[model samples]
Target chain A: MEYQDPEDFIRDDSFLLYCSGKAPEATARWEQWLADNPGRRQDVMQARELVLYIQAELTDVAAASATFRQRLSPVSDLPAPVFPLWKKMLGVAAGLLLLAGSFGIWRYISTPDWLEVSTPLGAVKKVALPDGTQMWLNGGTTVKYIRKFRQSRQVVLEEGEVFFNVVHRADVPFEVRLPGGLQVQDIGTAFSVKSRQQISDELLLVQEGKVLLKKNEQHIQTLEKNEGISIEKGTMKTTAVKASPVSTSGWLTGTVALDNRSFSELGIALENTFQKRVIINGEQLKNRSITITFSRQDNLQQLLETLKLVYQITYEISGEQVIIK
Target chain B: MNNLSPEMDVLWERIRHDDAGAVVILYEKHYTDLLTYGIQLSKDLDYSKDLINDIFLHLWEKRRQLKPVANTRAYLFACLRRKFYQQTGNKTQVQYLEDELLQSISAQSIPSQEEMLIAIQHTTEIRQRVQQALSKLTGRQQQLIRMRYYDQLNYEQMEAATGIAVKTIYNTIYNAMKVLSAELKGVPVITLLLFYFEKR
Candidate 1:
């Protein structure tokens, strides 16, 4: 496809995509073409100018593209397990239903009294609670607390995982409420809470100090430093986590240790960390449990390489989905 | 409008099946076109941008529900244009578009690049000429031209220095270049930008 005129070049979609810097292949192709056909640089340059100015202010589209990318996050389910898209939708639907049901009362109290903080997929955020407790929220996690803190330091870990550094005030108890009528009351301790519907389990890991696990105000168990508890339905298991207290501060700075974890948990971890979904070929492979340690800096490709080496499995990354066999 | 060579059918299918990466690819491929169309319709960059973001977000959520369509670009354009008009509270799209296109076409004036570059060799005269020609342009166009010739600076540095967003700077300068295309048609943009900065 030789373009004799600048108008022809302008009419070419690949050339336009090239000028827009949208199509990667088009850019390389055009660059090669420009090098090969030195005679056409003048015409090409002219076409480029036409493309750039023809849209005027639109030449700044790269910025707009980035803005769009940001908009895709935390909601659009940008990667595998662009995860929790349906669950998030369900939550929104429930909220809307609640709003509709209390329409008359909702008008006066439009904004909720609780302040919610959410971290998008593949990102971690450190938040300072009103009670002086520092928290590192994992990706896809949402924590809500009262806007005006007065007495009790109560937080609701709505979804995902959270690592806490409680500002222990023995006079005022700190309580964390989660789904399934589960509650974690701290007597001033640093710990982490994790829950996922896909696994149908909740995990409580204590980094330092002690935390009391409760179900609907009923005492379940007390976990001390370096102690962890995994509760799945009616059954429970206690284990000493293979993690140091230093590693619990922040995921990026410290090693994230997953012990006796199942494939579903690994899938959730990868999806939340990298925004890429993990798809295993067989049911047995999908349910297989493995222990792994990784930091936030580790990428999905690197993990895939590790999987290939250890499991002797092959994989392919198609868009956001990571397929393992 | 340009027809995309990308197999939209394949992308459409993948997105419907909850392939999120497909959505990203689609967004990248059509962001510029949608932006150009949206801005042209609303004559408001910020509003057009916000609406574009909203529509894409909606697309991700509704990917499964969307009926199959033959023309993806047309479908996207229809979506954008409808939302654009709906939000602006105006349905007279055809007339408004025609008027805008006509006004742009009428403003299209071209000067010979060969002649412009042949005589202006001296720095002082080039500076004066550059100043004169640039004075004829609007403030936005002038700012955009400045953004263009500062190619040595990365987008981040330029964005930080000018307090302008990276997304918009590239876009406006192209429009400003289009404005320049009229004054010095067929000239390399870098050459005009050279003449521009020498003046500074």
Candidate 2:
């Protein structure tokens, strides 16, 4: 680390690294080298200054926080953002709908506390939440929320899967509770939550924004756009998904794109979509990774044919069960 | 630059890791170029300034999801261009989006105001000599020098930036520095450099 020439000091990348606040060890070494050889101070600083000459200039070079000071409040001073009064408007709209006899009088009286929305097999339905979130329920999925959204925006994903294009609010969290103590809270984005009896707490896929995932009310993970977490049995893994953008809008478009998923997982997806028992027979193939895109309009037999053509796998359909080998 | 600093990737990594200081460096590093390009496209100084700010704001907001980008200039230019497009808001036609109009954005741009400021600052006698020395350096030398001295890129990163060899970068910068040093003749180069800016 001894340097005689000023050019030698300049030639050393560590010198500039120290100059730009990079590589702390280099800074320490430069500090030591300067202390040991006090005479090199002018040369080192001069070389460093030569590099600074070419530094780009800015109209405003304030610190990052100061630059944004006039526009966005500092994180500490940021009061919770209050959204438009959509919920109150929704209550009025619902009352009008009630007067128009959209709801059966008996049904409205019985479950005035909880409103429910569900989709049958091979069906995709969109429900507008009281808070202005556009929720789309996939086949065989059920979601329930408080009828009027009193305390906070929360939904219970009791069965199957659901996607939400949330109207983001700063303080009022939009949470989806699932079985096995799994919950997903939207962090200003469109996301999905899934829960199944077999898989327990199944999946949390973020389409656009971000979501915080928790298990049994404890914070587990935060997922961002095109990021997802899959839970099987009791194990969970967060992943930065490389699936195509087509997959982000898959369920609603009736085009399901599964990337690097196991055979059994594919079977579970098939069961959810078709409402049939999808059994993967081989232990070797059960965990084999598969990536495919298929339309929901395709029958079970047609999908099996696709699997046969692309993956070279055969399947046997017996009554309501389709077993892949 | 032949005097390569070689640290843009590392800088970008720090920005991705929520290093506010790193992002500030990135902002200061590219802000002028971005504004120049923005103004060329939009033809509005205030709008261009807003677009530059918006680019950095989006960068900070989406830092966590950023993919690894090798070319910082291309990346920022693309972001700035995107912001310009968004500001124009559905052009009456595909005017700027066309490659010719796109090229016009840069082709029409002259030496940035910063370069003009550098020129004005070189009016003093000693600085005029430095400027003379600077002018004598080849175009490649000036570019490599700027990337190295200003951008703080190392030899390898400079190689990545210019597709020139590290040894070549070293030699080009070495030759350029020799010219500057000869002109200064025993003056600490930093003193002249500091004095040159101090006049501002």
Candidate 3:
């Protein structure tokens, strides 16, 4: 009957719900109120307009079906019916069941045998590649290589880290490509390439193999097993000393063994492994570093506890956002 | 004449001969509208298109020896609905079997505008959405509107189909009209997008 303040009417959930639910009499009443209160009708009209816009957007159906049908081959003349002995003997009922069953089986077992294994976010997989090369797929890692090793072993790494235990094939050198134009060629031996998008280039740890760390033609460093090297854009240098294989590749075995690694470096490794958003709130947490055997599979609580025990640092977890203080 | 009527007759003839012309005709006529309808539910055009393609390909492959149909369109609509649910990762064929086990239900009733829309739209996307919005209402609402507007089906027939009091049907349709009127406001003639669905 009487007009209410259109602004107040628009804000009322019942009125909004009635409009949203698309009741006509209520809409008429709402419109009547808006007309009566022309002073604030514009605001009320805007709300009504938004709902109207969405409703008027009826989905297109014919175009979608045409698009889908176009994907199939054009229907031509049908093949003449062939009378198979089995079909005649089995009858339509039996033949249909057998045909359906065989099709189902074929679909299930047809996944390619090429071992293209991918570790879930915050998970690592230890796999033996085709050429007897052992690979420790770090968390959020992906490696694609044919099941059968052919001439010049090739693999493409999309993201995350991996440690390659390349089988010594001197004729077929194993090459690992990092994010930047950095390449590590294994003549024969074991080495680990740890790279992240934000990190400069890839950090190389030669555990057993002799790796020629090359950055765009210039040989940055020739690292022996047990030696460590960091390669960035046009620059590469040997670390202060070599790292032990157990500590370097310990992430494969669910333990992150850190030997004098910085807090930032350790945090980056943990973030990659955990696939969780971590925010370092304090400068002290960024700079603080201590040796600790943190479990890769451990929850944030356990990892934080380990960090607290090692460096007396505390942390907070809020939904997906983790704050290391 | 529209491409639909002629192609429909040809498709039926082809289907009688165990050919997959019906599958091709159905695809040619309705692919876009179905995609548009699927997109509203999926929010991803590429995924919806892929799912629709898979459904049609499967239908073509299985067309031969399918049950002799009194109404080919109805069977295809039901199959499309089943496929939609399957692609959405919701119901399974086992669920349909279970539904069959739960007693053959639904009273012998006359159809509504919603059902009419559904039957027509399965071949296209625009009609499907229009039909879907109508189907959300009680069957009585749809019947009243269709009787008064489309076929002019008498009140008694409408009542028979809807299984509702005739007076309630009148109120239901009246309310539905008002709702549609409000929603349809300010939509420009060019922006109607009637042919938009098939472009997918």
| Chain B TM-score, one value per candidate, order as shown | 0.49, 0.45, 0.40
The docking category that best describes candidate 3 is incorrect
lDDT tens digits, residues A124-155, model 2? 66554655456777776777887656358888
TM-score of each: 0.41, 0.38, 0.37
Task: Provide fnat values for all models in the order shown.
Answer: 0.11, 0.15, 0.09
Per-residue C-alpha lDDT of model 1 across residues A1-325, encoded as one tens digit per residue? 6577575675454676555442334556787997899887767765664455444333456555554554454444333333556655644544564456532211111134676666766666655565445677777777788766546678888788898767566677888987656799986666888876666577778776788988868998888877777667446444445434433433533345677777777776777666687776777776687877665567779888997899787889999898888
DockQ for candidate 1, please give it. Answer: 0.08
The weakest ten consecutive residues by lDDT in model 2 chain B span B92-101
When 1 and 3 are scored with DockQ, the better candidate is 1
What lDDT tens digits, residue by residue, belong to model 2 across residues B1-200? 11223588888999787676677678776665665445334433334556676777667656778898756655677676556655444442222133434333332333433433343333233334445666777889888876664333446546644668989999998787667655544434445434433443
For candidate 3, lDDT tens digit of each residue in B160-196? 4445676876677667654544433343211222232
Report lDDT (CA) for all predictions: 0.60, 0.60, 0.52
- CAPRI class of candidate 1: incorrect
Measured against the native two-chain assembly using Cα atoms, what DockQ does each of the candidate structures obtain, in the order listed?
A: 0.08, 0.08, 0.06
